[model samples]
Target: MVSVQNRRIVFSFLLLIIVVFSSYKADSECDFKAIYNFGDSNSDTGGFWAAFPAQSGPWGMTYFKKPVGRASDGRLIIDFLAESLGMPFLSPYLQSIGSDFRQGANFATLASTVLLPNTSLFVTGVSPFSLAIQLNQMKHFKVKADELNRAGGLHILPPSNVFGKSLYTFYIGQNDFTSNLASTGVDRVKQYLPQVIGQIAGTIKEIHGIGGRTFLVLNLAPVGCYPAILTGYTHNVSDLDQFGCLISVNKAVKYYNALLKKTLSETRTELKNTTIIYLDTHKVLLDLFQHPKSYGMKHGTKACCGYGGRPYNFDQKLFCGNTKVIGNSTVTAKACRDPHNYVSWDGIHATEAANHRISMAILDGSISDPPFTLNNLCRS
Candidate 1:
């Protein structure tokens, strides 16, 4: 009994409703306004030097004019992640100058671990800014942000929005393995992994308790493949894996990663409405090592800045820089002409080029776990 005009009007209304719902869904998926990072040197923008202030030149030659507290030559994975999100590079919480905490803060520090400072495994000695301390700092930052929002009359997010909508990233645990392996053996490290993962889980629960709903947890990379670890230890031919990496250490890394993934899965279940993503950085790094040409890397095993040594072109005493003391002799770590072709900047961290590739993969979901990519999580 309806007129033709009424039928057309109803069809147009239905179409408009569909378009509006779709737009709403898309907006909800990609509305991350801030990022908060917690970990060690791998993600530290400047927290270490803010506390120490002893680091010097040839460190930030690739990007910044001088050492900016980043352990690498240039930008890190955290930097690249922020760039992808169209957010400013996060300022280290300890940094006092030119800081724009409107996006969020970097609570990571060099040599930080999931364990408490009193633990025997913290090789760098007892640091005041442990992960627990960093968590506490985040709490303080939230309160300060709230105060600023109220006073300045700026349109910054409220405390609830800041934590709830922000992306929380953790790139830790390598130091724990390294310290433990050096102090205690591999078997002991393996046995202690449960406690380590438990601590990580506990930290996540604490953050969730404080309104953090989204998390991106990067698992341990191939620590055995690091030039520092490679040159530091004396290993038999059997100890080396096919990739010329330490076999036992890599095996331990795999075990730790597996346990970490399982733990995150459980944490995700326990925390309702939470998004916990376990990024497979190991797989990405291993792929780059196996097929360096694919990523435009010419030297996968060698460090870009070091005394060019055999097998891995890395010298333990002569780190990445113009000068270092090698067995009482002041030796210079000659920087490579083309760092872009190399995967590692120093003997430990990835070069900016490598970090960029890894970050792109993470954003595009190539290296992320299923059902959650950095892009999707930010949008969601």
Candidate 2:
């Protein structure tokens, strides 16, 4: 009934349709357009300097030329996550110094607390932008969108924008309890943690309502294990090596992380477009602490800066860059060699390499169940 030439033409068209369909299906399935981050120094790019200089110094010596305001040697959890996703490193929301937000921005500060009246006072701490404040910023972004539309400018995301096309990430609350312990004691954790955890859940719901569906929530790492706290307090050697964790602080971290996991599970059940995935940073970090050789980390309990004496310095005078005055005598913190290889437990925070590893793990889905790795997040 058909000629040979007509038969060939039909077959060619069928092949073309198959190719086009495959391409389109792939694109539609994995289309992530934006990444919004909120949290503290662990993920902060440069939020510290917005309100204070001391919050962003000495530690930022390796990757950055001087200090770009990060509390670490260079980079943080956010930077690693962006890099893993093949996205640009996000600029700090407070970094008016030099960055283009046409890409993304970090709202994390040094001392940000997740709770209202967040009872802590370390100079240049987390801003009042609590989780609620960060969501307000998103609302403010929408206001900017309206203004732009009125001015004949295109909106970053129009109302018709598809859900699950962006990823919302949070790495907050370490300062809430850490500062509490540093200031008063861990006993107060039981009293205030419930309120803080509730706020976290509320914040996630708000983001989901505001059009965020693909979400990643980083759980608290071992708070008792930070080099700053580790060096500050005298520890039982047996307890330290057995877990490489501080019992008192870690106990609080467990309670908070457990509550956080439950909160995320509830959010997943309630929201349609939203999926709250966890990054067990606490467990992974402890594993890393116990097995430093696997990640090429040599230092665990000591920081790259700060006084190297036993039960390391905590007073402001003996800080990483501060000059100490012992009977009018001055002393400065020490620096380490090859910071790229060292996992900072001190000089205020962890090293860039450490963040990169965590980011890679998170992107690979090793941090969550039914994992959604970085490649998976950006396939389309």
Candidate 3:
């Protein structure tokens, strides 16, 4: 027979084991669950270039080991976010060439924008699908996932089962101000910003309506600093960094975010199931610009892949990688020693590594205030 002390020891051991097992199970279930993405090139993994002819070179040489349609060499913001959540990278909607949605999906297109009416960024035959269209695609995905689940096929965890497990990330609004409104003027930014904010809020609400309970909305990065825009225009050198990243543009972004916060607050009050968390990419970008060394970046003022120098920019030939190079013009564009080591990708977009840092920051509960943080919106 066991002694009384031995019996107590056994009971304590059993209780400890139970507690450990419970904690393990909770964490295991939190593995990157479901990822739904909507936005433009910054987060697009290649939806636009899927059908277009291959001419651009710097398109996808870094990550996929070749041009895979994503604007970056490897992944995008959404990809890293998915990874952080312990989920496989979501497939681009156009990558239907041979995709299995059981994992996750992406509806972001290279040139898509948040503008309500939607406008073209360039005349390169890039279709600027609005955010609304992307939302519709997500709805279709939801329907398809349900069908697959009912048919006994592999499927994403249901929105119900995946409620807190799922995360939707948005990286939009830059093109609206840069491609559509900026060329027009800041007045246009001030004029249409309210409508822009409303549409974004409506998009989030729509997602919630369709069982999307958690969202991570990344505000637009500083547009004024894009190498493409900054290098070409003739402006005061003193105000260049602050140019494309105009006070007006940043102001508009702040206003939009403020409205979004209010809208989300009201939304959560009415819809207990839905929650929206705002991530501040704007400040991150600014920090990167002001302090490149801290982020291990070398060139914050110029693109690593474009062609141009001093007082003028001319990357019209698409020279980042090599579908357009004829017999090798010595590869005029420059790539950093290590892309993973750098913060900015190309000259305008954040590299996969940089995005990963930001995503981690969000998870670590670093930025948690209005116009920058969204801790209140995301609750396990």
Candidate number achieving the greatest TM-score relative to the actual structure: 1
Q: Estimate each model's TM-score.
A: 0.87, 0.84, 0.80
- Select the stronger candidate by lDDT from 2 and 3: 2
**lDDT (tens digit, per residue) of candidate 2 on 53-142:** 655356677777577777777778787767655667787666656665554556777667787544443334446666667667766765
Q: Lowest summed lDDT over 10 consecutive residues: which window, candidate 1?
A: 153-162
Task: For each candidate in the order shown, give its overall lDDT on alpha carbons.
Answer: 0.81, 0.69, 0.64
Give per-candidate clash totals.
Answer: 3, 7, 10
lDDT of 1 by residue, 117-232 (tens): 67765565545677888889998888777777667644433444667888899998777788757557788889888887898889899989888888899999887888878888
Which of the predicted structures, 1 or 3, would earn the higher TM-score when compared with the native?
1
Alpha-carbon runs more than 4 Å astray in model 1: 1-30, 125-127, 151-160, 322-329, 376-380
Residue runs of model 2 more than 4 Å from their true location after superposition: 1-30, 53-57, 118-126, 154-164, 233-244, 310-316, 345-348
The candidate with the higher TM-score, 1 or 2, is 1
Clashing residue pairs in candidate 3 are 32-85, 32-86, 57-321, 57-322, 58-320, 58-321, 63-73, 63-74, 224-244, 224-245
lDDT of 1 at 236: 86
**Backbone clash tally (model 3):** 10
Q: Could you tell me how far off, in angstroms, the CA of residue 169 lies in candidate 3 after the best superposition?
A: 1.8
Question: Which ranges of candidate 3 are over 4 A from the true structure?
Answer: 1-12, 15-28, 53-57, 116-128, 154-165, 241-259, 310-319, 322-334, 340-343, 369-380
Q: Model 3: per-residue lDDT, tens digit, 1-380?
A: 99999999999999999999999776665544667788888888767777464646555666676777777767776776665555666778777566655546778887676765424332232355679888888877777666766777564334335534567778777666666443555566667666666778888888787767777777767666666555433355555334233455455566766776676566667767555666766777677655667877654555555555532222645445533553655556656546665555666677666666666667665653333332332322
- Deviation of model 2 at 74, angstroms: 1.4
